[model samples]
Target: MLDWIFLFLTISLCLASRLLLSKLSNTSKKKQTLPPGPRYIPILSSILFLRRSLFDFEPILRSLHAKFGPVLTLRITSRPSIFIADRDLAHQALVQAGATFADRLTATEASRLLTSNRHNISSAPYGPLWRLLRRNLTAEILHPSRIKLFAPARRWVLDILVNNLKSKSETGDGVVVVMESFQYAMFCLLVFMCFGERLDEKTIRDIEAVQRHLLSSFVKFNVFAFLPKITKLVFRERWNSLLAIRQKQEEIFIPLIRARRDRKQQPGNGDGKNNSNRIFVYSYVDSLLGLQHPEDGGRKLSEGEIVSLCSEFLSGGTDTTATALQWILANLVKHQEIQAKLREEIEGVVGSEGEEIKEEDLQKMPYLKAVIMEGLRRHPPGHFVLPHTVREDVTLNGYLIPRGAAINFTVAEMGWDGKVWEQPMEFKPERFLAGGSGEGVDITGSREIKMMPFGVGRRICPGLGLAMLHLEYFVANLVREFEWKAVDGEAVDLSEKLEFTVVMKNPLRTRLVSRRKD
Candidate 1:
């Protein structure tokens, strides 16, 4: 009888303990709720996402932010896209608690096609591979000390741009439309940096055409990101078109790649292939030739992978900088007083004629830096950064951000925040000057994320330093060389249209008056 009683007691205790553990698990689950967003009816929501391309998706998100709040979700794919428009929350997730939110989402079919299964720095996951690729670019190529080495190359491209504009100004009523020239000029410079060769005009243009085509077609390929198995079949022609573009890219780039590889493998330690142009001191391709994939059994990068990386390097450095140059010049043209003031500042620093404004002089001209900063603030080339993902479930502003979900920050909105800027819409360079609101703003978001034209955190654009130098170098030279004036009939439109980067809806058509007279 006593033995039976003890057995009953043990069974009772086991049941009570199990009940207690189950109740605790249920309570923990109740605390995690997704950020409020549009009700996802699956098919309809996906259709809406497909219809609204990256270029036009802002308007939809703006309305959602109003109803749900700054931190919200949009389930456009199997995964949710959470956009953070608030600066504090963005800082909280991207900086303060960075490790939990540092990973990138799995590359979609469209991205994988371009990046060679996520090998490039921009698309690679946040791990050993991403670290290796990013470090290679930053330390090997884009380091601040290394940028000065490209001074001659910058001058070469500047001459090409100036001459191109001059020839146009000499004819056709002298209203030189500048966007195409800006892009081509950037391509020529970057090509030399990437390939270790100063390719001829025809070759540079050929590469430019292919890259521009890919960038413009980016929006059209978004459908391939969702239900790609079915979408590839449904949008068969589009898929084939993308494939054809990639093939043409390989054809153009592979020979250049092979030539570099062959030259490096030549007799006498590559000395036989010494370049006459001083611009060949180091090339981006040379670094790539020596890189080994960390996770892929230490194998050298394949030809296709090299081409994809080269494509990223070329496209990234070319378009964004070129687009930014146009806007800075456009604003200079639109506001003549600001242009004259800028010219005066350049004069103060660059005292001699026939002598170029070297990168060194860029420091003395405070107003010149201000103009570039204001241009970026007023019109960041990309309104939103490349999407970021979380490594683990995280909370921002009392909302749960699930692991692996993509997060996008509102770049343009942050720059234009009324609380941040006095006259948010105005093209005012003064804002960045001393006593101005933007004075000493930290763009890297390492301290605070005032504006992230390049993005922030561990994955912040590795090319940030290079991009700035290019902008300052080009803008300073272009202004010092020419007096940009508005065309008589057409206005310098600030209205934006999304291309690979957001560009002026109506491209800048300006009349150039040469500031330098021989």
Candidate 2:
């Protein structure tokens, strides 16, 4: 009878403990109201909703937004990522409440290894270090004046591009795969800027190969990004591959860095007396070498940091610009009427006198600007911006956004919003004209977010000014020099496939015939 009494008491104690735990869990859930999302499953959560590849996940996210509203939570493993598809909300979060949402997301093991512990601008958290680096880049390398100094480099690359295309068109059956040539031209231009030396074709190609290989592998390791610690053990081969790529990068970039450093250290080079003009033409590496971080007590950047910055500079300028160039050129080929109009505009402003288009002439040609903007809107290089994180728990649209939650803005969706743009799917450059609906639309999205191809707020792309100049300069020159006609048998396909940037799936095959013999 005493044993039975003890057993009853033990059962009652267990029941009370379970009830108390349940109450606490309910209270916690009520305190922090997460946005509506798909039902969470144990361990897997919403990750099962993703595709085998992350590049193809944009469409799925769009569908989720349609069902759960513009703001929704996505529980990918243990982390909850909040995605914002509405333009106003994005402006509010990235601009008005900027600091609260200004921090960068925690880098994955692969990203950390690639970025050298988040030293590069895109991956760097919002802090003094980011500001210093960004200011140095803008003032020293990417300023309008600095960009003007690289005019010769641009001209050299353009000449090479024209000559190669002419030769290929003459030899081949008027159908040439122009993507490789375009990529090489862009690489050459950026390499000259990064290293301050015109490298031979072989070296440029080697660097391009390694960079592209690493970029291609980045998306493939998406699973490892979330489950980094465990996946390192489970996916040993992939982890090793990433390490090898990093090692290869170091090997290539270090020599380039040392050469520049050695040159700067030479007696006359430092005085800025004998080589004043040359010294004025500073490369990105020169600026980085001189940077002394205040937060780190005047600590100079390490070799690894230099490599990561240089790699970022090269990759950021080349791949995205090349991809955008292809899309713009392809559109010109597809819409012959629009192409004719643009050529007419170019010829009108800077006559068909066989002279290269000057940067100053770009301001006079509104149609040309319109065409480029339209292309960016239709085919943004990145479907989504790099993930941003909240510094503290904040409320957005009356929903609690807990601290450390990852957030991303839908770049492509904002551009394609039918509510803002009339006939959003149609390729209409006229929409950006003076009297049109999108006239005076700001790409930065500070005042209002009509369209944001380069993003906005404190983290807007520092290279915006340079990127615009490159696009306009190249597009105008290409059209002026050649009549880009679609191949008779092989038409231009606009279908896109995801890479580091969204590139043409079939690649652009076109017929190029020089308008002027000169």
Q: Against the unseen true structure, what C-alpha lDDT does each candidate score? A: 0.84, 0.84
- Kindly report which residue stretches of model 2 are placed more than 4 angstroms away from their true locations once superposed: 1-29, 43-51, 267-280
Task: Please write out the lDDT profile of model 1 over residues 272-308, one tens digit for every residue.
Answer: 3344423235788888999998998999999999999
Model 1 lowest lDDT segment of ten = 271-280
Model 2 lDDT tens row, 386-421: 778887788889898877888878898999999989
Model 2 score (lDDT): 0.84
RMSD of each: 10.5, 7.2
